[model samples]
Target: MTLFFLNILLAVIWATLWNSFTLLTLAGGFALGFAALWLARGLLAPHYFRAVPAVLALAGFFIVELVKSCILVARDCIAPRPNIHPAIVRMPLDVRSDAEIFLLANLITLTPGTLTLDVAADRSFLLIHAIYATDEAALVAELKAGMEHRVRKVFGT
Candidate 1:
């Protein structure tokens, strides 16, 4: 967390030095700060550096999933006979914290053809409504391996 704050400070300083407080300039500063921190990572706690890549990977993975979902949903909509096999699947939860669960639920809901219906009262699982859940087991496995796994990484859980 300290490293994160330091990075942000560096970015702000860079923005001030450049005499432009625009988003682009700030982002460029952040990138440079990240590079500097990464290079000097041996002096700092290792986890923070690892987290940067993990967050980036999660973002990239989410974007890919979002695009694929959009395409699939669009195709189903355009078809004379849509092939979707909708189902509400109970996905067992590995993420325990409220923040983790909240993020996972929101990400699932943000996808094109999926919605997070409800979380189990015990917080042991999530009820997900999927538009293409012909194979419920596969859907659960995919979510477990993909989004849940990435969320865990981001939180270091």
Candidate 2:
């Protein structure tokens, strides 16, 4: 949580320095601080800095998927005949730590039409409910290529 605290501190400092304590100013400051920390990775923590880009990629990917999922679900609602093949797919995991797995699960769950039901006891697999799971293999491949892959890449350092 130090990073988050540091971000807040930087925002506050920025407001104090600029003499304008608006939400937009604080947000700009936080973003500036994040950029500063990311650029100064060699002096600070390398792993955290390395994860920033991956985290950003994941965030962008998530936003895109979220929008797509929302549109899909909305189309289903509007259509006279909805054609959704819902299923619970058991997917194997290769992420190293619990935090990685948790983040992956949360990312999946946060997106529409998908829910992370549970994680295997060994942390080797996750049970996910998907609304568009027409084929298990295709869904698994998609997950592997998208969320799972990005999560592993983010924490691989």
Estimate candidate 2's RMSD in Å. Answer: 2.2
Q: Residue-pair clashes per candidate, as listed?
A: 0, 0
Ten-residue region with minimum lDDT total, candidate 1 = 44-53
lDDT by residue for model 2 over 45-123, one digit each (tens)?
Answer: 6666566678889889989999999999999999999989999999998785989988999999998888999999988
Clashing pairs in 1: none
lDDT agreement with native, every candidate:
0.95, 0.87
TM-score of 1: 0.90
lDDT of 1 at 22: 99
> Scored by Cα lDDT, where does model 1 land?
0.95
Candidate 2 residue-wise lDDT at 40: 74
